[model samples]
Each structure stands twice: as C-alpha cells, then as structure tokens.
Target: MMIGELFDPQAPLAISEHYRPHWSQAGAIVFITFRTADSIPYEVLQRWEREKNEWIARNTGRNADWRKVLPELDPRLRHQFKKTFNRLREDFLDTCNGKCVLRQPDFASIVADSLSHFDGKRYRLGDFIVMPNHVHLLASFPSEETMIGQCDSWLHYTAWKINQQLGNKGKFWQQEPFDHLVRSPEQYQYLCNYIRDNGTKANLRSGDFLYRQHDNHQ
Candidate 1:
C-alpha cells in the first residue's frame, strides 16, 4: 500500500499499457494531468503517436513479453523518456487555443464541482487547477482496489456533464490522461508547485484558472 513498494528495485511492479507505461501501487498519492480534446496541435499529436508507436515496437516487438521486459529496462532511460514527453506536451498546452471553452466562468465552475464531488469518498483530493483547456490534480486513492475504476468514473462523469452543458455529443476531453505516482515528498511538493503556477506559466489571466481544495490540502 505504499509508494516504496512500487519503486523497490527487486519487486515486481504492476504496469498498465497506455501511450506510456503506467505504474500503479495501492494507496498511493498520484499526480494527474489531463487535457481537452483540442489541447494539442494536430501535427504534434501525430508526431507523438508515431514516436510512441516506434518506441513500443522497438521495445516489445508486437509481443506480450513487453511486460517481462519492462522491469528489466534501465530506470534512467525510462525516466528521461517520460520527462521529455511531458515537457513537450505541457509546452503545447501553453499556446492559447482561443476556442478554449473552459475559459468561461460557468464551464470552469462545472469542472471544479465535478472534481470535488467525491472528495474524501473515493479519493483524498489535493490541490487542483482547472485551466482553460486542461486540469492538474493531486489525488490519493483510498486503496488500489478502486484506483482505475474510480479514476475512469471521475473522468467519464465530468466529461458527460460538461458535454451536456455544451449541448454537444462530441468529446470534451482527451482519451488518455498522464498519471504519475508521487514517489517522494519532494516530488509531491514539486507537483503542488507546478499546479499552483500552471496558470502563470500558461499566461492565463486571474479569472481563467480555478483551484479548489478541502481540509485535506497538500
């Protein structure tokens, strides 16, 4: 149930396949970054998809053995790949897409309420900023049993509610979200700082981003 168990060199870690490797552990604090459907430029997304597919093919070679090979891979290489990809993605999100619907106060308020609806119930929510086209959150699940399901439910409901408000049947958010487990207090604090300053970095006005927290603030 601890983050240490997930990072132990000798231990077998649980990983899920996504755009990148997703590592999960029971009762861990995780930082999540998700964006709207139009958040990334089409060209950038196409390139990212191609690169990721090539990396997967090189590493796993169209086989299930990738699971076995994952843990044996060098940690530094994996960390660097993830870090570089995140930086690129964040940079893309910074450029203003004037069509950002969440910039509207009403739409932003909807997302904020959706995020906090299950606070202290499904997960202990931490500091979260609802930006114009994306959101960053620090959430710790009550247990591993509920991690994936609860996470999916939160995204699904929030997207549904937002779409309803928009009166469109189209997608509201991206299909894949970036999730990283906070391995240390230092990492957690860094994520907190990042969320707090996300608006400034994106050149957002004061009213553009909304942050909500309860007593369980990070």
Candidate 2:
C-alpha cells in the first residue's frame, strides 16, 4: 500500500464551494467528516451558520466572503475558528441525535463496506470510523475531481443500500461533507488518534460503532 502525501503549501490548491468551501490538493491525505441527514437539527445548524456569519462580519468586514477572508487571517485566529467549529459539531454529534440507525451493526457495516470497496484503487483509504450519526475518514486521491467523485459515489451508494434495507427514501447522508487536507505528519497522527478515540469519547459501547485502521496506514 502506498503511504499518503501531506499537503504541500507551494502546490496548486483547488478551492470549490457548495454550502461550504472545499480545498483539495492532488495526492494529499484528507480528513473528511460526513453525517446522516438528520444528525443535526435544521434550526441548530441554521443558528450556527448565522452566528458564524455574524462573527465573520464583525471580525473581517460586513459583506466579506468568509471563504476568502478566513484563509487570509492570522494562523492563530484561523486555527481558533476551525477548532471551535469542529469541537462544537463534534460535541453535538456525540449526542447520538436523530434515529442513529448507524448504531446498528448491520447498517454501519454497509457504510464500512462501501468506504472500503474502492480502498486502494481510487484512493488510499486510511483510518475511518462509523459513529452513530456520522463518519470520519482519511484518504488521498490522485486528483481533486477524483476525491469529490468518490465521496459522492460512496454517499450515494451507501444511502441507496441503507435506505433500501429500511424500505424508506429521501435524503440519507448530509449533502455537504466537511473535508480538510492534511498539512503535516503531526496532523495525520492526530486524526488517526481522533478516529480511534471517537467511540470512547462518545461513550459508546463496542457494538455501537465500527472503527478501522488499515494495516498499512501507519
């Protein structure tokens, strides 16, 4: 198995926007988080967005594009903002909100299988965990388009399969996922630890989640 590469600041970075910004670097390992559609309540997510926008307006400027301004801020400020946002979301997700069907081993296995199906072909899959309502993983893609396409493929296929098992339809996974390019070896180790400890952090029992670290990930 090929080891993943860290993000190179000097390399050309690809930025794309949907509900949020996505930064991609070819062959760079990325830490990604995607949750079930109902993992977070709509009102709560809206409020968080409103607060974030307000903060941006106050700190940067009114009508400022956060996507553009955020990366230009001082490293400390940027890190603080990212840290706070992630902590808040992580805390909420740990609450095991919504139906949390992924808590079921069979349902969670469907996601595990889907994630690993293209492991070494499309991307180098690393550590990943299936939480009650969300998932976290590390992978490196050959190109930005491949990364985005594979994510879509994983979500779409798993949603179809899981929903089919339940005999229900509608949105399964959240439309937009949170992804970040790994910038250093330290950060990569941090993410691996995060995935490994997530279940315990959530106070979940063994059967409540599925965690996997590829043998060659290290």
Candidate 3:
C-alpha cells in the first residue's frame, strides 16, 4: 500500500472531469477556482483597491498630489463609484452565478474564515492564494480525517459565508474543486507558481491583493 492511493484499480478511470489528489500520504496541494454564477461585473473590487491605495498614500503623506484631494472625495461619490464599477467589471466575470468569487469582499477571506470549521475539529490549512475567481491552497490532515466528505464540507461552508456576506441567495460556488497531493518538491514549486500567478490572469485577481498564506506545517 502506498501513502497516496485513493482510486481502485477495478474501477473505471475518471481523470479529466476533476482533479483529486490522493491524500493517503504526506498530503496534497489543491488548486481551486470559483467563478461567479453569471460572470457579474466586479469592478467594485478594482475600484476599491485603487481607492484604498490612494487613501494609504495620503494617510502616509507620500508626496501628495491629486491624492490629497482623493481622501476628501464625498462619501456619496465613493459609494457611487464602487456601485458603478462593480457593475462594469464583475458582471462579466460572474459566470454561473453559482460561485461568484468577486461578489465577496476578498475571495481569500472566504477560505480564511472557512478554516474555523477545522480550527478545533480536524485538518490544517497550508499555503494558499485567493485570486478574483479561484483559490490555490495546500491543506493537510491526518489520513483518516481527509475523507472526501470533509473536503465538501470545507468548501460548502466557505460558500455559505461568502454568499451571506454578499447578500446572495443562491449557490455561491462551483460544486467540484480541483485537488492534487503534494508528491515532490518539483510539484510543490509548480503549484506555488500557479497560485502566485493567479492574479496576473487579468481576471479574478481583479479582487483584493489582501491574500494570506497559512503556515506550511502540520
């Protein structure tokens, strides 16, 4: 018996449909992407970032210019810009309306909060990045606790939190998630690159850069 073998030889092979890392061994590095149910324009995200940057610059007194004026912008304008921006951006990316990652404050926050479920229960979160539309994460757990059911629970719980915050009333995420067991150093590096580059896609990375990485330990 190997440390990472979950499939049965007698069963039919089903690979392309989804990626499921065998968790019998050290653990796996999972790359999960969650798009909006109908590709809603999430321009509010980018606009918010720009505003935040301007505010940071002003508060820090970093060679002020128009930024000095930015801080004083009327609250009404700020709200209006966020509202219109979101309609222009996320509306296009909110495909499926099921997993509207952009609908949330920071897609990463959804995953981070979901970790609470396993806080004192089971499993541990590893490295992760939350892009506009998806997330790449490394999670570890005792072999016994790594059952597929638990995976669903984690994702499902996160979706609920995200939907509640976004004032959504339907499915907030895709049903299936991609997973891959961390087998070798090369594989780990490859995954890390993919996660970090997630923002460059000109798509979901459209969200907040407030990405956070859980420790890479058990």
Ordered from best to worst lDDT, the candidate numbers read 2, 1, 3
TM-score of 3: 0.51
Return the TM-score for each candidate structure: 0.80, 0.91, 0.51
- Measured with C-alpha atoms, the lDDT of residue 215 in candidate 2 is 90
lDDT of each: 0.72, 0.88, 0.50
Give lDDT tens digits, candidate 2, residues 98-154.
999999999999999999998889898999999999999999999988988898888
CA shift at 6, candidate 2, in angstroms? 0.4
lDDT of 3 by residue, 14-100 (tens): 233233332323233343434433443346446656765665465445444433554465777555544554444434443323243
Q: Which candidate leads in TM-score?
A: 2
Clashing residue pairs in candidate 1, if any? Answer: none
Please identify model 2 stretches exceeding 4 Å from their true place.
Answer: 19-21, 57-72
lDDT of 1 by residue, 1-218 (tens): 22222234344446777632166666667788778888876888789866755665675564334335445558875675567677878887878563788888888888788878877777777788888888888777655556677667767887888788878887777877888877777777777788888889888898988876435443
Error of 1 at 113 (Å): 1.1
